[model samples]
Target: MQATQPLVGKETAFITGGASGIGRATVLRLAEDGFRVVVIDRNALQVEALVAELVQAGYDAVGHAVDVCDRSKISALIDAEARVDVMVCAAGIGPSCAFDAISDEDFRAVLEVNVLGVFIASQEAVRRMKPGGRVVTVSSRAALGGGGFAHYVASKAAVVGLTRAMAMDLRQRRIAVNSIAPGFTDTGMTRAMTPAQHAAASALEPAGRPAEPHEIANAIAFLASPRTSFITGQTIFVDGGKSLGGLGL
Candidate 1:
């Protein structure tokens, strides 16, 4: 990881699903970069534990057990903050199911967390953000195209569209918006896959391995930084060439 210059002042970062996986990694990276990180997640115990750890490490941090889809609660938290310099919509769910096996409820659940959650958080955060603010949404390489988890793919694709529209809308405000489309990453979510499924994913990766959460965080941190002022409305693929095509399945 490249060293980041400590941000001066009390610049605050709000990250949803920040208790684990990519979200957790981003929280640590942002905090290390000198942002006062505010972690929001549904896992109360994990939220408290992570915040405690950051505090013990001498980093400015706090946490709340809040679902990203809860607009009122998310808005209230953001409203309470003095200022929100960065917002990372890392909260998402991707349950793999065959298209034929996907029930309406299953599909809705994925959209609720993966799409609506990001929309709600980004909306509230953008309202509170000022010029030069940053919003980074987590999309996925699957958003490009995939077989299993149709709902997950659709939700992520929506995120990409939403990100582009946000960047255009916020250009006048000078707030940059971007999305990172990570490939197969080693996280609790990926670990949930059956061993065979996991092995297949890893084999498909051009790097011959799954990405570490911190690797995805690295791209996110770059987009979240004020230095990326001119870059917006883009989907960066940190997929280790998996998205380059011709994997020969």
Candidate 2:
């Protein structure tokens, strides 16, 4: 592990999977909170576009093309800056396949990116964080369990577990580790559903609509904020009551 650097001027926030979806939304939200964000994604084109967009908005930002599951790539990234104030572990991929039909390779790929990827990112990022540093990870409401997405759900559950463990380990360092479990979010991933399927799926939620990326971003922003120091190892459900299942809360 590398020696962590002290945070300097213009607090820096780095986000994995930041080129699109929830991660992209997090980048913009943190930038608004005055972070010079570094967006990481394997999609070079999307990363470039996001960087350009941020610059156009007069925010300090940059892009890195990297895979979160690649330890070597991530090791190189852990030293990206002198100090990292916040790291959003948002890189994940969840593919759907029937339980019986799910290939070992396919399941492994999902876990690699969704589970191991978060672990690697958090491990490196936390090692590089200063005291009061923050890590906001993206889990899923499905971690509570659902049908048809065993691999993804299991991976997300792993994330929640990892979050608590990380919080305990980093407690002495004053680093907050937390996660957000989003449900029925409107994104490219949801867009893959047929229009009717999408609508019907969202209707199942008490909110009666899928969450916009920015809505979930709001949760990430709050968790990553310096003000959230007292809140650690908690999974904030941004899933619009879907986690409740008819239990009035």
Clashing pairs in 2: none
* Residue-wise C-alpha lDDT for candidate 1, range 1-249, written one tens digit per residue: 001223456898989999999999999999999888989999999998898888889898878899898899999888767788999999999988899999999999999999899889999998878899999999999889899889999999999999999999999999999999999999999999889989988988888899999999999999999888789999999989878888764
Q: Given candidate 2, what's the lDDT at residue 192?
A: 87
Question: Candidate 2: worst 10 consecutive residues by lDDT?
Answer: 1-10
TM-score list, all predictions: 0.95, 0.94
Note the residue pairs that clash in candidate 1.
Answer: none
For candidate 2, lDDT tens digit of each residue in 1-249?
A: 112232457788889999999999999999899887888899998988888888878788878899998888877765767577888999988777778888888899999999898988888888778899999899999899878878998899999999999999999999999999999899888888889989899888787889999999999999889998778999989888878776442
The TM-score that candidate 2 achieves is 0.94
lDDT of each: 0.91, 0.87
* lDDT computed for candidate 2: 0.87
Model 1: per-residue Cα lDDT at residue 124: 92
